[model samples]
Target: MRLSLAIAMAEEKVKEGGKNKMSDKKWFNKGAKAGKVEKREKLLKTYEKAIEVISKYAVTLFIKGFELSELGRHKKALKIYKKIIKLFPQLNVAWFYKGFELSKLGRHKKALKAYEKAIEIDPQYAEAWSNKGVALSELGRHKDALKAHKKAIEIDPKNALAYTNLGELFFKLGNLKKASENVEKALKIESDLVPALNLQGRIKIEEKAYDAASESFKQAMSLDGANPVHFLWDTYTNYLKIGFNLDSEDKKYQEEIATIIRNLEKMNETLSKNQKQEKEMRAYVLYFLGHFYLKSNDILTAKEKLEECIKLKSKSSIKASARELLGNIWNYRIKPPWWRWWLNSPLYRWPKRFGFSILLLLISALLLLHPFIPGWFPLLQINWSLYAFLIVLLIIILFLPNIKRIQIKGIEVELQSPPPYEPVLSPTVMEEIMKEIEAKYTKLE
Candidate 1:
């Protein structure tokens, strides 16, 4: 504080000593540099002096606001931007940045208004249009987002962000072919674009091309350094799904699992940086952690993480997924451990058959003892009646489709055969679900 005051006094002394041009320019540069370098205390001091020195300089104010937004001090940046907009109502850039800051704060409707104002001021502003599309997308106005992105592209044919946004818009709309085309165009223009790469990876995953999807995610990770843990979570979860084969003993599979766990540990460190205030983020991270642990056969850890996820944010899709996974965990662990322990035993493969035979024998013994019951003769008779019943049962078991069986640890566990149920939600469907959730939350807010 004393140093800043001393610097401010020295700067003022230089300004008053007949060095008007040099001092004014130097002070403005110093203030701008302070903002850029995130010297917040110094910047605030310089901000007060800058108003007195270059009171008419709108560019300096915009630079300050931009720097604040970059530093994630979005509400403060919004205040600066609002002041800029009030003073220079015709400045499209001010409105554009106000919208940018508002969008950063998740005020999509206000962002849309600010973006619309910027567009109204300058129809050819491709960046504003692209950002408007993002705001529209966040607001669940898919059609408007499409139009805004298209308008951005029309205004500037080579705008890579416009192309990427268009690709994401198409992805949300479930037109994977068009999504792929636009993302490819974006990559052609800017190959290292993280969002485009992530979107491309998502599209690959939807097509069940897990290897290709993983490669794309790897490329994205290379481009996007490891600071923000959210992207890491996405990459880790993709790897988990691809490498998750509960019964696999393959060397390659084991290596992939090891890599995923290592990545997850690093992500855990990243999450710790802001975990306290990020309840939803905690839920997301824990959900994936639970999923990875489950796939890695760490049932206890999986159950713990998933239950933590539910307790943190009980309303999200992450919570729903966590609950589903927890139910699966309980169902799996409740079964006799011996069933899994004897995975290498010869009878393990046909344990269900042996168990079924034992059950039938018990029934036959009961029927023989209770011959007075109706149909006891046919039920107890094994010469032809029982043989016919066994034949019919074998045919039905062999030919007729029943519940899907997942062979886990040598046990053919029968999965619930949902009656011709709709397929699992794809990324597009998940987008709609998220939109619904956000809308509900917005209404509550």
Candidate 2:
């Protein structure tokens, strides 16, 4: 019986030991699971913090890039944007800014790709779409540009920039009416938008509405005080358009010319110091000022300005224009050759100036010399001298004023043809020129 009890005790001990082993295994598994959960939570927290730090760094870099762009360091800005893109490939704004810098650098094709990437990342990127339209326009894909602008407008109905861009495109296409309508819409949406105001002014100038165009440019100048040179230049040129059409002797003609000079001076003052230092800008200013003075018959002042412009190292085209105007002035200053003096001589007026005196002298000479003259001479035929005198006297009385009138008319006509310089503001030429200027100088929307 003792042996059986011992065996039973051993069996009990074995069962208890098995149960302990199972319990130990369950506790170890539970602890291991808790430790794994803790580790996973810590990893997730670390990941979230890392993302937060990267996002903050990206924002900082973006601001730096924008500041560089504002300073006109587009190449440097491009590098910053590229770095941002490398870090955060999904950032649409980074892509858009990359495109902006590229456009500023005149790489429109590359800019178009960057803008497309931004749009692909975020289809509702209105600014990207609008800028893409500009790239397309630069590429001469007008239809695609139009579609892109329209899409931008559809995406954001209040996109004044898109409207202005659309208007500019229409203007390029020679649809002045449509251009005006769209530009007007842009102005309505944002009354103080400088680009819209400037475009409106350009359209009115095309329509020959000088007064309205002046007002629009003036408004633009006021609103865009920091960059008023363009508006000021436009206003000056608009006055020039009016002045060129006016009779020099008109009471208001000198006043108009004076206004043009004042506007130009204001433009000079408005130019930034760096711009003032630009030989090209100074050449343009001097050339136009000289041109205006030349038109107003201020030969000395015109010669001075033109000479100054010619002496500067400027663009070939501006220098060429200056040289041409200078040549005109030189030709004008030279007295006509002796043979052509009759064109302006008192004798040219004939009967109006000296006919009566000459006829009397002739009659006296004939009376004095009649006795000495040959009898067969035609001068002694049938008292012909008296008839000649009477006819000459009649012509003097009847046609003197008419002759003076004709002389004045001829002077006016000559004055009209004196300025052979083709105006820089010829509609087609000015449109392209101003568009280029705006592209260069105007800030991005």
Candidate 3:
């Protein structure tokens, strides 16, 4: 009996030991899960901290850059923005603003590179694509410009600016139907859009749809008053050219110019006299006033107004028209000093600048290398053979196949299986693909 009792006690202890092992395993699994949760939370906190750290360092730099841009110190803005990009490579806004500042400075190629970098960082960046297209348009790469605009539209279907840009491109290409379609789409999205409305009116005028164009321009004027564009001036004058008592439309044109003159006076008065905007307003008003006088066949008042416009702002587009009109007068237009010869020999209009640059560079470089290379040897001696060799090498590189070639002669081939038949696209299918690619050329942004 004692032996049997002891055996039972041992069995109970073994069972208890097995339960304890299972409990320990469950506790361990729960601890592991808790540890993983803590690690994930820590990671989230670290990411937030990184973002905060970057923001603290980058935001002030961006602000300083913007202030520089506003001050018209574009080079400074570019440098600051570049620094921001280098310091915070993930900051797409810095790249974007840098491109904008470069565009303002007329550095289209550099602006394009900056915008491309921004787009590379964030492919869905609609503004970058639009601005890139603008730079391309300025560079006269219109087909590429259209592609970028369409790309922006693709990323954000609601982007009215992209549609307007596309419309302008189509208009320039003389695809009036497509232009109308796109501009109308932009207007439908934002009825108050003055630029699209104004352009639509211009296109209508070009198409000789007088009433339609007038309505379009009138709507544009209602939204944003008094543009300096000659289109608005010409549209008004054409309306005035309408013969009275003949067509009702003729009276309409005459009345429109009168209304435009009144609106111009209001626009000029509304602008502050102390501001630069005032100068632009005055220049435009005087230019249009001159146009009005010229239309009435009063050459003297036209000459006076145009000369006044010329004196107010040297950079106005109206300055060109003013110079043309004033050509019959004293004609003291600020003609280029080398105006006569510039057309014939543009490169030599100021050849001295280039000569001076070359001489200065040569002198500085020779001075630096005086101990090694004397001035005479540096100035007179030319390495013709080196240049020739470089040119020949470049020619060879251009003519050669771009792909790298490899030889497999030494490698043992598997004695072979039957060659598999590969299905390939036919000529017709390939042609279709080419056309598809051409279509994509319209929307590569």
In terms of lDDT, which candidate is strongest?
2
Candidate 3 per-residue C-alpha lDDT over 54-84 given as tens digits, one digit per residue, 9 for 90 to 100: 4554676777787776555779988888877
**Candidates' RMSD to native:** 15.3, 23.2, 25.5
What digit string (tens of lDDT, one per residue) describes model 2 on residues 1-445?
A: 2122223333333445323333323433433444454665654544444355446657778888988887778999999999889868999999999999999988999999999999999999999999999899989999999999999999998999899999989988989999999998998899999888888887887787877887888888788875644564565556556655887688688778777877766655444256634455666667778767766777778778878777776754667767776766654453344323323322233542365456456657655676656665755555667756766655444333323233344563222234565434355544554555566567767
Deviation of model 1 at 358, angstroms: 46
Clashing pairs in 1: none
User: What does candidate 1 score on TM?
Assistant: 0.57
List the candidates ranked by TM-score, beginning with the highest. Answer: 2, 1, 3
Ranking by lDDT: 2, 1, 3
What residue pairs are clashing in model 3? 147-442, 239-253
TM-score of 3: 0.53
Off by over 4 Å in 3: 1-87, 225-259, 271-275, 297-300, 329-445
Model 3 whole-model lDDT (C-alpha atoms)? 0.60
Score every model by TM-score.
Answer: 0.57, 0.65, 0.53
| Worst-scoring 10-residue span by lDDT in model 2 | 1-10
